[model samples]
Target: MNTVTRPRILVVGAGFAGVECVRRLERKLSPDEADVTLVTPFAYQLYLPLLPQVASGVLTPQSIAVSLRRSKKYRTRIIPGGAIGVDLKSKVCVIRTITDQIVDEPYDYIVLAPGSITRTFDIPGLTDHAFGMKTLAEAAYIRDHVIAQLDLADASQDPVERASRLQFVVVGGGYAGTETAACLQRLTHAAVKRYPRLDPSLIKWHLIDIAPKLMPELGEKLGSSAQEILRRRGIEISLGTSIAKAGPEEVTFTDGRVIPTRTLIWTAGVVASPLIATLGAETVKGRLAVAPEMNLPGEDGVFALGDSAAVPDLAKGDGAMCPPTAQHALRQGRHVADNVIASLRAQTMKPYVHKDLGLVVDLGGTDAVSKPLGIELRGLPAQAVARGYHWSALRTNVAKTRVMTNWLLNAVAGDDFVRTGFQARKAARLKDFEYTDAYLTPEQVRARVEGARAPE
Candidate 1:
């Protein structure tokens, strides 16, 4: 008697699109239909939009991190690793496990959604000096770092050193940079009140971006409103500016203005995962090129989405691709799963079209700007809309409850501004987290796989 081998479905990354895809596939596909697997270092899907809150102590890290195994709908076999390379022709994916073991995973169907890394330029001392906001660890590290600055400044006698320690320079005017600057600044403000000896006026935050306007996607009125709110809070907004050089204690702006600060948070932009380069496929703006159906052009049983895929935007209907946003990535994930199942069942696959959902920029506290459903809102109303949207988008009820509870507790009791001593405990630099040189070459992948199978 011979048993029929089930089709293997492997998914890369646990980001917004990758998590959604695995969830949908797990729900739709039966055990006999396919065996699903997911490759990721962590078993949780990070709610990236609220990372700033984590750094600001508004929300705990665990509150925003949705566990993958929490739901009973999960049926996929999770592999604790990150993809290093892909052999498209051989239907194989090479993954670097948490233990540093290289394993080759074979699949009949594959979904590439390895997400993105913080895009950095060749600015001097950037990798060694700057902090990042892309991961939970980074947020936690930043929280401790920001609070530590206050501690050190309070203990210091030198006025120049205190001023430098009190200053923070945030690069990028996009959502992450803007929100991070706003949230962390609020943290410092509430924190400085605790130190009677430290001058509150010495604490300064400079928000600089190459773009002329802040959050241009939020439209003119909403963008201006956010800028005004931040400006009113004493934030220095330097428009049409970028970092020329990043140093240990200073960052020189492109406009030749030098800022002396130990904190340099880079939230400029993101590039597609280095995994995209392994496929050696065409890309649109650093992302893997995919059809409107979220499948590779001529590659059989392979699909890509999220920040790594340049999925065509049919709703725009002008040869445009979907922007790398959670809204688009989640929707695309569901659609790709449907298409994959449709393909297996010999049914028609549908194209992924995204409708405009406007934008939201939470400036911490009651200050926020939103253009939900094309209606511009500001202050408390916008904050409500923004938080409501994010809260509703969380995958689990437990996560929502924790986040809401955090908000309530923060409102009633406020923060203690305690530094967990992560600065001396760990290296929280940009290079320490995102290693640009970590990916494996194609030859190295083949050698490792062949060597592993040699014993057989």
Candidate 2:
């Protein structure tokens, strides 16, 4: 390899994968050897596993948001923006800043770890009414919005309005939906005591999914256990059902049940970042196809991983791809970085093979479920495994300390049902956060890269 200046390495997305990749690159290579730049909408890597706690007010946003610049490798340039387009042929990446400025950044090598966004469908009124729990702002907004519902219900004399305000419909019984319903249900259960005028039974939480069970990843036994716990707490668990129609005040399920509720949380699933489609590459299951070494075949100086890329599940040996998870993302990020460094030095690169560690679901309170190293656990034991995994996943000590402190404080302190009125100014909607409408066509991408025409 021959070069006058150091290779400019551009990493898209400051998520678990992207952050770990940059950190590894920073540690392995000096600034004089290779320049590293990261593009992300935020300066912090969100500890997404803890986002439910944030939505429940158990943990503050800052506690789960790990800082990017605090690492020992401080030379990496942080570009606070999201990648809108990538011109692989010209080796230029187009970025849209937080302020909406479009800029083109040239890179000698690029890492695509753009993570994911909430998956939504064509359900009527879904975008305008439903809330999401993917981002930090969404979690905080949800916390405020849920509390606001209780406050509004307490003050309103109209039973109709009060009933609607107290009921919450959370669609999708995956980990996010399950944990969200569980945690927030506990919040309202403990909170209704403050509202002496309000009927406790009016506060209802419905966890619905098209799937047959709750958190099937936790396995059947634990999944059944989670369902029983939620049922005991009076949470209406509806399986094999999804939102047929959604409105500001009510949601109609596919099973012909119309539920009145002011709050609707959509956690059905997540698709790869829209940026992944801009590359005009073949994808496997909505994710960019990548080699086990995390490199794009036939394309030099390019790598993709995390939820955005279909990383082969080498450990499974079943022609399968690694599941989109924080655990896999963290490992992929670190391994991809090492592979990138090897490419820079013209050295041999190794394939990424990771076995599944386990799964954990914090149902809030003392109840939880986990499967660590194939051993199923429930109750207190599961809670420890769940928390221990999250605590260790946090990159910085500051984040760990804050999260631990928040956990301790929340356990000891009594519930304070206060609404910040976040939704009063502007209701939290699905469309506001992730820009699902933004994406470039294959023709547009080819034109941009080939210099046939400017990207729109």
Candidate 3:
């Protein structure tokens, strides 16, 4: 009797980890040996680090998102869907396709890299009044919304409404929040020139965070310099503070200060996708707990990486977990791929380790800050390095070229300031993106009511 080995690997979420894993696995395993399938909600990989640039018109949205098929030359199949649930015991994953159809697929091995979703706070009116910057859709919506607001402010006859429309508030001093404020401020400054009726001074930019310092991870010197640049550009920086309440017209701060603003961008933080909770596995800080090799303990043939996995940072000397950033995710993806191939061949797997390689921040235009190696840099040189680094880091040549072209055009001319007009009306609900069971279909509701009335 002859034994045939069946090997099919399912990779959830085509972000940094899943994409790298599939690309490497394709190289390591021959076409006859195994099949690789990559699952994601979208067809492209979003370069999140430079998303603020996209929102501020520094780069078009297409520049940051590289299509999966365009980048990979291997035979990996791309499955367009979001994994809703995973039964670790059965090695089956329940996925919800874009059209809302549900399907369960089984795999010989699985790599969980579902990534994360925006972490919302319980502050009053936040869900109704705040905008999140987690997805490409959200970023695009913000870009349109900001430009639209400028238009509205210039056109409005009422002074109060005009003031509200012009004022922008962002909560979170972390990299995402700070970069967003910087980028949007630059956008409005350039855009207001087109609207002579509106003063750039009327367009207020406020950045608030509960932390004592901005970009604390960037160290004191660089963070302070970044904050100073933003302040000089008329951006109001409020540290050790947060919003207590947010209304349609204004936001009240915890410190009893109130600001009239229609825009409240939230980049406070992110947590692992809800799919992790459905896996029935131990998780640390909402992430699936995994060994340094990115394998789930006690779960055979199952692995996890990227933001969804709590990978220990051995390079830190201490046992702290790796921070969720593109820097770590890129490296983790490669390590996980090698480990997976090693596992398939019954070989020893190496541990994942990486040190902080400094940070780069583009403050839109010629203002930027960075600390490549151990030396701190700022101003035009920093801006050059920052943009250059992002350009080089792009996964595909198409994305790289598109981004470069956008920059060149912007430099020669200026922002078109043309709104895509997607979010003329607000999308205030999470269910708008991912429908929940609480929202039953008409058929489901009727069936449920009928089943209730029919004797048990």
Candidate 4:
């Protein structure tokens, strides 16, 4: 008797797109149909939007981290590693595990949704002296660092040191930077009362962006409102400006102004993961280019989506690619899963299409701005919409409960402002978290895959 081998489906990333795709595939595909494998550095799908709250001590790190192994029905093999390279010709991916072990994984069907990393420019000292808000570790480290700064400021006798320690700089006026600045400002503002020696007036938050407007996607009126709200809270909003150079003690702005500070949070933007380059495929603005159905044009059984893929914006048309947002990524993930199943069954695949559901900006406490379903809202109403949307989007009941409990606890009991001290002696930088140089070259990927298959 002859036995048939099952088709292997490999998904790279455990982010919004990858997790959604895997879940959908697992639910739809029969056990005998295919073997599904997930490649990821961590075991959780991080709820990235709430990372600011995590950094501000409003929510615990585990609350936003939705575990991947929670599904009892899941049969997918989870590889505790990151895909560093993909050899499209050989249908193999080169992965670097958490223990620094290298392995080559082959697949018949591949979904490239490895997401993105912090995008940095040619600016000097950026990789060395900046803090990022992308990952859970980064958020936790930032919280500890921020609290330590306050502790140092309170204990110091030198006025200059105190002043520098009190000042914080955040670049990028988009959702991440804006929310980070707002939430952390609130943390410091509330915590300063405990430190009677430190003057509240000395705590300054400078929010600068190279773009002319703050959160330009929020439109003029809403953007103006956000800017006004932040400015009212004493946050110095500087438009059309960015950091020219970063130092251990100060940062020099592009507009030729130098500010003394220890904290420099860089949330400017993100670029496609370095893994995308290994395939040597066509890309639009560093993102892997895919068809309307989320598949590579000539590559059989190969798909790409989320931040790594330049998926066409069918809703907006006019040759526009979808913006790298959680909304689009989540939808694209589900849509691509359907396409993958369709291909397997030799059925017609549908193109990905979805209208915008509007945007939400949580500025900590009751301050928020949201345009849910095109209905503009602000203050308490906006805050309600923002939190409601986030709570509903959580994948698990446990995640929702934890997040809700955290919100209630924070509102009633408030924060303790204690430093975890995990990142005390370590220097956390852009290069540290985002190992951009860890990816293998296309030639190296091909060699590794072929070498593994060769007889010893």
Query: Per-residue CA lDDT of candidate 1, range 323-437, in tens?
Result: 9999998998898999999988889889998797978888888999989989999989999999999999998899999999999999899976877777576667999888668
Cα deviation of 317, candidate 3, in Å: 2.1
Model 3 spans > 4 angstroms off: 1-5, 425-456
Cα RMSDs of all predictions? Answer: 1.5, 2.2, 4.6, 0.9
Q: Which stretches of candidate 1 lie over 4 Å from their true place?
A: 442-456
Ranking by TM-score: 4, 1, 2, 3
How many clashes show up in model 4?
0
**Candidate 3: lDDT of 316?**
89
lDDT of each: 0.91, 0.90, 0.84, 0.94
Per model, how many backbone clashes are there? 0, 0, 0, 0
Query: Which runs of model 4 end up more than 4 angstroms from their true locations?
Result: none
TM-score of each: 0.97, 0.97, 0.93, 0.99
Error of 3 at 69 (Å): 2.0
| Whole-structure CA lDDT of model 4 | 0.94
Stretch of 10 with least lDDT, candidate 1? 444-453
| C-alpha-based local distance difference test score of model 1 | 0.91
lDDT ranking, best first: 4, 1, 2, 3
